[model samples]
Target: MEKEFYIDLIYKSFSGDLSEEEQNQLENWLSESEANKKEADVLEKTWQLSANFSKDFEINLDAEFAQLQDRIDLDEKGNVQEAIVKTMPTIRKKSWWKPLSVAAAVLLLAAAVFIFNQNPATAEMLAMETLEGEMKEVALADGSKVWLNENSKLTYPDAMNGEERRVTLTGEAFFDITKNPSKPFIIDTRDAEVKVLGTSFEVRAIDDEIRTEVVVKTGRVSLGKKNDLKPIELTANQKGIYNSKTGKKLNYEVKNLNSISWQNNMLEFNDLPLEKVLEDVENHFGIKVILENQDLLKCKYGSLFPDAKEAEVLKGISSVFKMKLVESGERTYRLKGGDCQNTSE
Candidate 1:
């Protein structure tokens, strides 16, 4: 059968409007072929997600029929009654395709309404996405899971099957993929790709400027630019940063394979400049910092701050360098006369 015909049949089946003959035909086709089964599964899951359909999987065409009757009654009794009745003959005389089309339209509307009213948390489970500074842990339709990080979004089909499990990602996320050697998990990030059968790894693909970085905490993962089909594999405790613009891969020297520490609100920097540190503080903690002296921008320093308090962080910085830190407002701060140069090694 043609793909469109099966697609239409799947929609009709879920809508409880498929005739007995059509239902049997669909079942036979799905049973006879793997390709048909996969397509049916995807369509069924899509319908479930889009409509919030119950797991019990019973569709009442009678209820739909009742709704149609109500519409007919309202239209007939209303001011357009005569015109509608006059038009009824035309509708009734429509070809077989007409009734199916009308039924599909109504079912689509009902499905849309069901999806629109779905709870956001439930929707997230069905299709995970995160905004900037937003992090979440989601369990997928499969036993696998993901930890999404700041400014990231992920979209997967409602279900997974077949030889490859595919998902689209934007920004950053960590995956603790369950081992399924038969079906490798593939993450498409537009410019880069991360493929693995089972592994725990972090992928950071922010703006086009920053190189896409993948840090493998366990197992192994393959990373490559989207256009580059061949992937560079990273073993445990290894980090690979792919420069999107130049397509160069920078392999960072590995030390430990700890889970990403951003959640603890602690940032570990080695020999990073104070100005650069302040930039991170502003982004994660949501505050603005100003340095009065241009030279201070080059001063290197390191410290840990509770990701919660911007003021306390400034205080710590001021104390460390003997500088004066002042808060201008909730959004802005200024630093002056920090013995930053003298304090540096």
Candidate 2:
């Protein structure tokens, strides 16, 4: 295959312009060998880098293109083969400010050369998340740590610079921020901004949900809205809730830090509705517990389940509520029964 044809296919693939035949051809070529796939990867990365190239540095295009063209020619003629591998180092050393014939040449050469040599870790920002039934631990460059809850996402820059350390959160996460008195740590949720110098806290902010919650485990945290000036400050064992639509703050204190008991693989239900309990179970265990009768959800119970198997918890619930547990599907169960008041064994 002509090398330019593959290059054109790479451009089309990145631009989402690949037709069925072109996609099939590219896939076939890629599957033929690992080298072809690596070549494709290089081309794709180059295309992306060219699209988002930082304008801070001036790139030399004419000299770079000529050097690249020479390598291509040598490869085509099967001559000067020893120089092929050395072309990358030469391209890396080329100045970015040199004059080019056209913008197209700049994009192609800069992308193909600089992108190939760039370190992926230098990217401006990184995003992380936890899938269902999984909790993840992430250490930021600034020494802060984050424990992402199941089905949660956190987006932060590779390095924390500027006047403040900022991160965006969706769903829930427990943060253990490293103390930097000059630079306060700020969390941007859907409804509120949580500011703390150095503290351990939990933020729960679900998209489209009416309320955003923050619980400070240690140190202090300030909760404020984007449009409001008076921020609600809370200390350890204190909780704050922000109404997303109404812009109201509700602050309170809890008896213990058991609100984050899930960190220890424990589920604590403090007289919560059965419906909410089942939802928490599903979120933590990655299962579906369907209430066969909606009325059954009215039953409320409080208990602590520590590292117990799903079956054991299900059996306990069945005995407590006098309900029947039936298998609906894999990792799914149906609870069938009428609502019963809290029963003592």
Best by TM-score: 1
Query: Where does candidate 1 stray beyond 4 Å?
Result: 1-126, 129-137, 147-152, 179-183, 196-199, 206-212, 215-220, 225-230, 235-250, 253-264, 304-312, 341-345
In candidate 2, where is summed lDDT lowest over 10 consecutive residues?
104-113
Assess each prediction's global lDDT (C-alpha) against the native: 0.59, 0.64
**Model 1 TM-score relative to the real fold:** 0.49
Could you tell me the lDDT of residue 285 within candidate 2? 68
Report the lDDT tens digits of candidate 2 across residue range 169-221.
Answer: 77667777777879877777655677774456666656544455566555566
What is the overall TM-score of model 2 with all chains considered together? 0.49
TM-score of each: 0.49, 0.49
Cα displacement (angstroms), candidate 2, residue 51, comes to 60
